[model samples]
Target: MLAGHAASGQAPGTGPGAAPPTTVAAIQQLDRVEVAGRHYDNAVGSTDAASQGTIRAELLKSRPALRPGEVLEFVPGVIVTQHSGDGKANQYFLRGFNLDHGTDFATFVNGLPVNLPTHGHGQGYSDLNFLIPELVDRIEYRKGPYFAQTGDFSAAGSADILYRTTLDEPLAALTLGQRKYQRLVGAGSSELGQGLKLLGAVELLHNDGPWTVPEQLRKANAVLTLSDGSRAEGWSTSLMAYDATWTSTDQIPQRAIEAGFDRFGSLDPTDGGNTRRSSLSGEWHRRTDTGATKVAAYAIDYRLRLFSNFTYALERPATGDQFSQQDERTVFGLGASHAVDHTLGGLPARSEVGLQLRHDRIRVGLFDTQARQTIGTTRDDKVRQTLLGVYGQTAVELAPWLRGIVGLRADQARFKVNSLADSANSGASSDHLLSPKLSLILGPWDKTEWFVNAGRGFHSNDARGTTATVDPKTGDPVDKVAGLVAARGMELGMRTEWFTGLQSSLALWKLDVDSELVYVGDAGATEANRPSTRRGVEWNNRYVPRPWLLVDADLAWTRARFADASPAGNRIPNAVDRVASVAVTARELGPWSACIQWRYLGSGALIEDNSVRSSSSLTTNLRLGRRLTPKAELTLDVFNLFDRRVNDIEYFYESQLPGEAAPVADKHVHPAEPRTIRLMLQLGF
Candidate 1:
């Protein structure tokens, strides 16, 4: 059968009610042109509501990112920033949720989960420094909890980054910037045999950054893939490896900066981190006249060692409060899915069933450190976490202008912890959750659709939190927290493409969680307590008025708070109130192209009482390029074009300095990078 027919069973210009194919091989003579072009478009036209969108390769190429992980900023309402070294994971914010190290937002690349559970630094810690943006084909993102294909760490949203299977041509690029920044990348794909292809890519980078301590970041990344067959029937295997190390300049107290300290100065120069990740993954797929089936599996080896000093002299006046968080782990997972077209009450309907399983074996520890040397141990444990999930979803065309989707998902998680700190804390815990999802889509009137979506979702707590018996610091008794926290979400949204070359979407969403997962920086663990709620409105627009010009805009406003009344007040700390972005791109403008983008992050509460708030920040970036030849180009990128002096991140907490008699509440801030320019040269063969 033609790849498109086997994959989707839809013909050109077909609507949602297209008929199923009669024979698998009937259209085999037809090439897979449609399938190739619709790969990313399918994500946009899928049965999901307006809260979902896709970023294609064209958009990725048009935007210039200060950091590799900033590619995720393409997702509406997402803000990507870094408070530490460039080699570390970027901090993430979405929909009023401070998703510290990716606690509530799931991220996937080429079917491999990027979020790590039961990590030493925090729960669901995700690091995207390994990703090579040039190798990505598209990013599919969904907000809220309305998708059955999503599970843990998906309460707020999820993004699946798909890499390119093959490159049209070989590519080599080199970049140089201020402050000793340098990078080199090479990627290409080649045909091996009939229906077989090979792809490979490598990236290396080093940067001192604009820091008083000199970040001295060094990173290397590589990916290799082998594949055969068409989208209708294909098999692929891939291997990826990444390693990085850097000296971090952690957030500094605003008081110190005001006291004549440099904004980029470091309190503890030894603060830094080292991380490595290697993985092997494979996938198989088959398409029949009735449906399609896919299976995927992956195995990963990961390690991390981070040293941070947040409280300075709060705990140890002479030795400082510096500590180390370490995690070494192996992860294995498998997923299988099958989709079929069927009749529901004699109505055109589609059904999909999927099963997912994952297991993690981890050795995690926390230790007090002075000058990056361990002084004493706090907690050390070996944890094994396993999860199994099953889900089924159905979509039926209820009428010519209406469609309904219903889905149910069940997940079971088991955790076993072997604590070296205290035998009393070694234990096993298990939890199961059942979530139901529903979505209603109405109308295509004038190329517009309205949707209503509601669903339940959850995130797994840190294994240590599930079985802890005592505070490692004070030896005081402590209660164990739930192994899993649940969340519920609802959204009313609309999508419109009535205007030619323009697509727009608006969504009003609300989410409530049974408890918030707070990262205890000093303790090096996640604490689950205090129920929370968030409500927000988002509007996104993309306009392509001409073949060479594109304009895009997105805006979000949110309110987040603690569900229960408290003496400290109900405001959720670090929950941003507003976010806005605008971008304009001119591509292939007669060998000259340009792009300008502006991003805004509004002020937010720094503490529960909301007595102190962070200052809003706005920054702009510009990119100009000139095509030297059909296969060669040069580009210049100017980041923080206006040289806005602002804080990248802010936190309100208690800290004690060298001469202080007691701890005092103050604001800790990481200043944003100043204006800098980078030039890049690219060659294609």
Candidate 2:
């Protein structure tokens, strides 16, 4: 499965430019490492209270990758699953919390939520497979909720991805690389005409044949943006379009091979799925005489078809039969924000408010025939979500060195699900949510800052529009769910750059989530649980010793607990117990620069019937590249320098009942190509 997720949130701190370190401790600390006002800076010390290092651009480029999974070794408290020739997919955990779908850590893009809001019957899905690494301009991560103004998931903090804007110098970049085990990658981007910018990339990647299994990857993407710097009297208007295709069919270990596991299987490279997504968005900003107001509207069309050919099953034989599944989704959304600068309580303050509306449609088709035949069991559903939100915040100096910001964001969102069958639609329900936030920045000395924040937030229950299965045999899928989920509490702290070039932050938090989402009992049964709590801590920091050389590190630890669940009770699942990374790079060696990166993940734990068990593991990857010319470049990449197996997946099979009956299987980590090297060159002029 090829998927991706975005890490984003509003960049921290109110300061927008370089200013002399004031007497404010918190403000100074935040400002030192956050010299980013361009793209999106996630490592802005203001967000992570527990951060021990920073992940700035120089630090990032030293071991740059186009997606979060590729940069796994750089961030602590996270684990990555890599196929010999496939893309990186992460299983997230911060502090000790368990992430959804193995990949925790919520994602965002330009402040736009990407976690698929699904039917209330199941947990929301995050599609992190579409993240294109080359398009990113900057990445900022905060370990704990130390200096953050706002964040999602009461426990785990947030990471922001800042894409390059349509700024000067007519941006352009192309990457061409090869893996000893994988095929190749050819990606490029350029500016089109005036008022418009364009970017496109494609990968035909593959892995080694002599290795245990054969893996391959193919994908393409395009993006176009037109900007009018006139936001209706000092505002800006932008018209944008995005399209992409992704498919991955790598090595599939056989059932017997996975048990204790026999290690015998020939490579079958053509298997995974094919996916396409298209979206168009319009954004307009008005800086009229009456403050500034911004509005955006968007429409998205997404479709995916997966040809899952069974190669491995617990007790089941490798079914020659394949399940060709297809999913279609359409969504529409609108958001508007208005900021006003004024004086209240004899202090200068700013207030901003916004709103969002989204309509989603989903269709899942299960085709039962082989020979590439199609017989659709259409199960279609639609959901309308309306979110109403308003916030009021003000920052004032209680003294020359102390500043505080308090704000309340009230949000009411309702989800109405309607099934294709009228009888099954009664399960449709609605949920509303409101959250409050507050924070403070204290600068007690020059070039440094200290911050603390607290807030209340919540995630609503999903209504998938299908009725519950009343009968075990003819299970019913039905009525929409109602009422919002339980509210959560959060806290944060941060300190950064009292001087220049170095910054850090640390945070600890806990979240009590109500109506947990999960899959229970049968093969296709999905349901929501009673209550659960997620708690963890994160640390991030950055250090720049020279203009061309940079170094950085990060760590996140999480603990997610399922609480009061009837079918299952008080359990903590295994996600990486701890994740950490270190990167070093210098790009000024006359077009020849070297970057080295190291990643470490402690162990994951199994939460069942109360007690916990751990799976200890670790892995690392490295790469070296040279810029051949202005438009062409070459890179030599190596994965698993020491060839360490770290992934473990335990499962029970029930179908292959025979004299050769083996009920369960353990999937060992089969990532990284053998010790191989390749060079790629790309050019576009």
Candidate 3:
């Protein structure tokens, strides 16, 4: 092509008429290179900031963790917690924040939001533990609100999980290794063909991992998928199942508390929980010259259980007694989404029209096991909300090298809270939101592509993690607490490929969110009407210099601050100041591969209050693998290789407190894991 380089720089694959390597001359003849992912096996190669894949021949050749969460590590603004590597309670953080551990990311499996309608405080109780490693053929992340039909994603983002179809022939694999630092998993798939597919995988993960806590993790996962031909056809149906059971432990250090990294130093590893999820969905579509018409329906169920004793007995200055106690929460949800749409993209213009409806309900209860009474006397509550929306988007090819996309949507929700024990406290309210988006991509150079995007999106009220307590007198909690309403954000980004197989993406974003609920420090609880701002940047890069080796890196930095005065005075907890990672992968021998990953994390804010925070930290992971065949592989991995001293509590002396702040600063940092390693072997037939 242009010179001595490959035309499109795409890795080798088995497909019809693939593009030449990514050199100037080759690209001129072949417009774009296709990569493997959920939507299309032959879509253009992505230099996008939040897009990546493991299905690429090169990436798949090396044996690695089979879960989508593990692969997403290469993306910016994303950090995953294996719950001590157990896999069942797997967790993640985005935009320097966690959505109540698993609740916020709004994970999806095949265009379906994995969140359950009944999850407590919107905490994620979806089915991340459902799929066996083999069931997920590939995974994808659609960051921000760039696409149509998808709006109301607060600060973090959304993820799309794609299941691998069963092949015509039978396949089998076994990944036997340590969980946490060492564990094992086995998987297989079969194709009945003629409009049928099946995939399945199961794993046993154990980790006596990298934290100071007496770490131990165990969980099992399985996923099954049955789908008709592509949606382009007339009709299709899909079935899915997800499940996982796990328990984890944490031990925080007392000194790290003084450093401002956490609220408490340690958590008894004996504290543990179990979780599960299941779902089903179907779609029907008809294609035409002008646009494609489609209708779809989906439903999901999820559950979670937690049992732990709060052991950090920090003496409250006024009470002289720590609020130490045993706690448990049981939550469930039911929901369905129905939408009809006209898709427009193949012509000189792009457009989509659709309407969506969703209903969600959550029930929550907590009891102080030690005291033999519910923590607040009236601990049971029920909240239900319904969302209806009409959305549309269009893209026009302005010129040869430029294109633009414009989109708009309107949404409304009505929420009602009911509790038999506190009927008088029940209340009902309605809210509406409008969203608009604009995006433009420019191609000045064949290999250099740039994009600028701006959008305004909002949503009605919802609470996360923190819930209201009883009034102590009427057995009723505050009704209008923190109504999540009308949040807005803007996203700007760019992506490009450079010399020597390097690809990079940069994004800058800002968010302003307002909630009707407010927090009160004096009462050690919250009420209603609060606002905050989330602003940050995400930087990511990938380098595949040779056919058998690659390197990936990502950095996420944010400054999420209170936009209005709160009982804590413009302060919020759990938002980290910074996070970064670097990973290197190697495949020098046929059937052999190795990898190493490094992480750097700045201090994190406190969990329920802003007075304390987590500490700065750094850790590393190393792995080795050998491929026995195309469908089989083996590997060994070590987590927290250094056994670096980790601290979960960060305390500030009254000396460091800003004027008029709490004098004794004590924050809790959750310990990660201790150094550990695992060996694994997997096979496919």
Supply candidate 2's per-residue lDDT for 441.
56
Q: Output the worst ten-in-a-row residue range by lDDT, candidate 1.
A: 9-18
In terms of lDDT, which candidate is stronger, 1 or 3? 1
- TM-scores of the candidates in the order shown: 0.94, 0.77, 0.76
* lDDT tens digits, residue span 172-212, model 1: 99999999999999999999989899999999999999998
Better of 2 and 3 by lDDT: 3
Q: Residue 62's C-alpha lDDT in candidate 2?
A: 52
lDDT scores of the candidates, listed in order: 0.83, 0.46, 0.49
By TM-score, the candidates rank as 1, 2, 3
Q: Where is model 2 poorest over a 10-residue stretch in terms of lDDT?
A: 14-23
Against the true structure, whose TM-score is highest?
1
Q: Which tens-of-lDDT digit does each residue in 321-341 have in candidate 2?
A: 444555577877666655555
For candidate 3, which ten residues in a row score worst on lDDT? 9-18
Measure candidate 2: CA RMSD.
6.6
| Prediction 1 TM-score vs. true | 0.94
Clashes of each: 0, 106, 87
